[model samples]
Target: MNPLLTASGLHVTFPGRRGGPSARAVDGVHLDIGAGEIVALVGESGCGKTTLARALLGLVRPTSGSVGFAGAPLSYASRDLKTYRRRVQLVLQDPSGSLNPRHTVYDAVAEGLRIHRYAGDERAAVAAALSRAGLRPPERFFLRYPHELSGGQRQRVVIAGALVLEPELLVADEPVASLDASVRGEILALLLRLRDELGLAALIVTHDLGLAWNIADRVAVMYLGRIVETGTVEEVLSAPRHPYTRALLSVLPESGAEPVVLAGEPPDPSRIPAGCRFHARCQVLASGEADRAGVSSACRTRDLPLLDGHGRAAACHVHGTP
Candidate 1:
């Protein structure tokens, strides 16, 4: 199936401060989201998951590389950009911040239609969007203000705003990070429902591996601005191949394996390590096992490709080999 959104060799860099080196927030990421699919981009905070999501949404232009939507490369020219924006919506991490405090639920949901110059019945569109987002008897919430609703309801409003535009893809950055733990599952289930019922594809940026396990069809593990491993959720989560991926999974409460506590913080993106970016913190490189000499050398000096020639892919020299 053709991807609803595609990003290839996407790189985004920010200029340095005080003549220091530039920060490469996103580095050579290749990603795709098929129609009706939910792909989780998981990693530690500051690993560029949000930056990559912004690039995909065209909120930030890439320093290099291309992003294609529905087979056509994204065009930043004004008219094209406006059209693209309508089809690809963003749900930010904080609904409290994303929604206007002064705008009532009706106004918040209706704003997109007004901006897009939607010709349909504006009231009907807003009501339907709220309904789709799980705010049933949508009228009950129409006059409510952001502060008037609970955190979960506010998030549903944000989602409703996105749905109001009838977007084909949603780039949600930490959709549940700010909500109570009790409310997180409800929001996740709502997203899954939207996909199953409306065929909306989503790229969810989150650090929670457990969330990925719960809802993602595929999981892309990001480290230091690159995807180190990507595969079916079962394949990647059940049997992760990348050292970084394994380390992440090891900490999961249900893994029943001792947590593989990594050493050292992720290096500054401006001074990303050569070869394998994770080599500095890789357990295998420090183990000094006699049989792992070749793998260690490669991990320290050679940049391994993300693809491992199997259904699952990992950017590790030792991955998939005996």
Candidate 2:
């Protein structure tokens, strides 16, 4: 399938203060989001997941590498990139924090439409956008303020704002992380419904594997700024190959498995280990010898390349079959 957006060798680094070297946030990450597909990017906090999302949207200037939208290198100055922004919108996680306290809900959702100079009637566009976002009976929400709406309502307004642009892709950064668990499911369902109704392609950045399991068509597991594993939702959740991926999957509730709580925190980006970044906490490598099937030793001390195995690509040396 032809990709709607393709980013290759993406790298982002923040210069350390006091003349120290820069810290890598996104380290040569590559990703593709095809039309009408939902790809979930999952990882723990501080893993640079947000940075990657920003890079995709061109909000962050990558220290190195390029982003291509619809087969052309994205150029910030070009009308194409502006159009791209309109076509590829972002639905941020915190609606309460994201929305303007003073702006009426109608103004919030219509903001994008106004910015993009959408057709003849602005009010009609605003109403259409709000209706599509499930703020039904649009008039009810038009005069409502952010503080007046429920958490779910605020988020739906945010989604309505993004949808107003009629984007081809949506990058949602932990869209439901702050909501009550009860509302999380509703938000996910809303996104799924939008995808189906609008034929939207979405790249959902989240930490919860369970959420990915429920809504994503495919899952890409990220760790320390690089993607460690990727496959069909079933392949990844059912039998993750990378220790990090497996560990993440294990931690989800009722997975019928004990979470592998690898000891130690993720290494600082500037001080990443000599080999595989996860080696220090890798249980397979802690034994100091290759296990019976030669599966344990290399999860450490090797810069494992993502290779095809178990129907997807994984970066764990122990699990890459070929």
Candidate 3:
């Protein structure tokens, strides 16, 4: 199947303060989202998942590499970029912050339509989007403001805003990170329904592995600025091969394995260490498992190759297999 969106050898860099070295926020990431598919990009706070999402959406032009849509490389020209943004809408992390307090619920959801200069029945479009987002009898909430709604309702408004655009792909960054557990499930299920009903594909950026298990068809594990492992949800999460992935899962309540708390320095994009960016905090290397696998030296000295478009792959010397 052809991918609806693709990022190839993607890199995003931010200049450091006071003429310091540059920070590589996204380093050589290759990802794809098939039509109507859901892929989760999972990592810790500063591992560049958010930056990757922004780049994919054309909000931040990549420092290097390319983003493709529907088999063609993306063009950054103003008109072209606007069209891309319309086709690929973003659902941000914080609904409270994303919505304008001054705007009524109807205005909030209709904002996209107005911006895009929709010539169709604007009120009907807004009502349909709100209803699809589970805001039943949407007309009742039309005049309400963001502060008047619950956390979940605010999030629904945000989703409705994106849905109003009738986008083919939704790049949602931590869509449920701010909501309560019960509300989180509702949002995830809503996304699934949107996919089944509207044939929308999504690239959801989040730190929660459990969310990936519940919502994604495929999961990509990121560390520092790179995606170190990726595969089907069942393949990667069920039998994780990368130490970083294993460590993440170990911290979960249901994971019976001993906690694999990462030690040493947290990831720094400015000075990503030589060799495996994750080697310094990898429990597998610390446990002599890499040595037993006869790849300890390689793990500390050489960067693992970029993951291939294979069934399942890990970017670790000891676990570099598909």
By TM-score, the best candidate is 3
Question: By lDDT, is 1 or 2 better?
Answer: 1
Worst 10 residues of 2 by lDDT: 302-311
Which of the two, 2 or 3, has more lDDT? 3
Tens-digit per-residue lDDT, 1-322, candidate 2: 6688887888899988798877889887878888888999999999999999999998998998888888888888767667889989999988988999999998898888777777768888778888888888998889999999999999999998998888899999999989999998998998899889889999999999999999999898888878888889998999888788878878777698877887989988876676677778776677554466575545545576533212488776666446
Candidates' TM-scores? 0.96, 0.94, 0.98
RMSD (CA, angstroms), candidate 3: 1.1
Per-residue lDDT of 83 in model 2: 86
Candidate 3 residue 197 C-alpha distance from true site, Å: 1.1
Two-way TM-score contest, 1 vs 3, winner: 3
In model 2, the Cα lDDT at residue 263 comes to 95
User: Model 2: how large is the Cα RMSD against the reference?
Assistant: 2.0
Compared with the true structure, the alpha-carbon lDDT of candidate 2 equals 0.84
lDDT of each: 0.89, 0.84, 0.91
